[model samples]
Target chain A: MIKVLFFAKLSEQLGTRELLIESNNIKDTEQLFQHLLKYQADWSGVLNSQIWLKAVNQSMTTKNVVLNDGDEVAYFPPVTGG
Target chain B: MISVQKQDFNQQVEYNRLKSKTSIGAIVTFTGLVRDINQDQRVSDLTLEHYPGMTEKCLIDIVRQAKARWNIIESTVIHRIGALTLSEQIVFVGIASQHRGDAFAACEFIMDYLKTQAPFWKKETMESGETKWVDAREADQQALSKWNLENKC
Candidate 1:
C-alpha cells in the first residue's frame, strides 16, 4: 500500500489527513492522484486549484517519480515558515 | 541542532550553545516573532502546522547546504508550532563560524531557504475571530532567487 498524506490548507479542504492506497497499479504521484479522483470527484477542484508540492518518503519529488510499495507520498502548499 | 517544537525557546541559551566552541569567532542569530498586524489586518493569533518527518529532513538539508557553502562551525535552528499569540516567538536561526562574513551569510541563507523550502504552513486568526491561511509571498521567492544568483557569480 502507498501511504498518502496532505497538509495545511489542502488537508482542511479535503477533510482528510492521510490515506492508504493499493499500490497494485498506482505507479507514481500522478497516477495516485488520479486514483484518488476516481473515488471522490470533488477532490479534482481542490487538487487542481493550486500548484501542489509533492514529496516521496520525506524527500521533495516531482509528479512523475515512480512509487514503490510502502512508500509515503505527501502533498501540500508552498511553505511559509521561518 | 534542529528542533521543531511547540515550546518557546530562550535566545540566550541558543546563543550560548552556538558560542561554546572555542574556535568560533562570530555568531549570528535571527528570531522571527508574531506581529499584531499583517497585511493591514489585525492578527490575534496563529497556528503553525508541519509534516512530521519531512519537516526535519528539509531543515537538515538546508543546514547541510549552508555548511557546504560556508565555514560554519556550529548552528541551531528552532521552529515553533501549534497555537501562537501576538509577540510570540516563531522561529530562530543561529550560526557560528570563524569569521563574521561566513556567519552572517550562512545565517541569512538558511533563513531564506527555510521560508521557501520547508514544509510548514501558517494560518492566522484575525482580531475579529475570522481565520485564514496565509498565502506564500512572492517576495520570499525573490529573496531565495538572490542566493541562486550569487551562487552563479
Candidate 2:
C-alpha cells in the first residue's frame, strides 16, 4: 500500500488527512490521482484545483513520477510560512 | 541546528550560541512574528500546521544549502507550530560567519527559500471569529526566484 497525505486547506476541503491505498494497478502519481477521484466524488474538485502541489517520499515531485508500494505521497497548497 | 516545535524560542540564546565561536565576526538573525492585521483584516490569532517529518527534513536541507553557498560558521533555525496570538514569534533564523556579507545573504536566502519550500501552513482568525487559510503570495515565489533555483517540483 502507498501512504497518501493531505495538509492545510486541502485536508480541510477533503475532510481527511491520511489514507492508505493499495498500489495495485496504480503506476504513477497521475494514475493514483485518477484512482482516488473514483474513491470520492467530492475529491474530484480538490484534485482538480490548479493550486495543489505534490510531493513523493518527502521530496517535491510532479504528477508524472511513478508510484510504488510503501511510497509516501503528499498533497498541499503552495507554502506560506517562513 | 533545526527544530520545529510548539514552544517559543529565545532569540538571545540562539544568537549567543551562534556567536560562541570567536572566529566568527558577524552574526545575523531574522525573527518572524505574527501580526495583528493582514490584508486589512484584523487578526486575532493564528494557527500553524506542518508536515512533521518533511518539515524537519526540508529545514535541514535548506540550512545545508545555505552553508554550501556561504562561508558560514554555524546556523540555527527554529519554527513554531500550533496556535499563537498576535505579535507572537513564529520563526527564527540565525547565521554566523567570518564576514557580514555572507551572513546577510545566507540569512535572507534561507528565509526566501523557507517561505516557499517548507511544508507549513497558516490559518488566520479574525477579530470577528471568522477564520481563513492564508494564501500563498506571488511575491514570495518571486523572492525565491532571485536565487535561481531549478524548479524541482
Query: Candidate 1 on B1-153: residue-level lDDT in tens?
Result: 999999999988999999887999999999999999989999999999999988998888889889989999999999999999999999999999999999999999999999988988999999999998999999988989987733210
Clash counts for the predictions, in order:
0, 0
Worst 10 residues of 1 chain B by lDDT: B144-153
lDDT of 2 by residue, B10-105 (tens): 877888889888799999899999999999999999999999999999999898888888998989999999999988999999999999999999
- Enumerate the chain B TM-scores of all models: 0.96, 0.97
lDDT of 2 at B99: 98
iRMSD for each candidate structure, in the order shown: 4.3, 1.6
Per-residue C-alpha lDDT of model 2 across residues A1-82, encoded as one tens digit per residue: 9999999999999999999999988989989888878789788887787668888999987558998899999999988887
Put down candidate 1 lDDT per residue, A1-82, tens digits, no spaces. Answer: 9999999999999999999989999888788888877658689888889988888888876548798999999889988898
TM per candidate comes to 0.96, 0.97
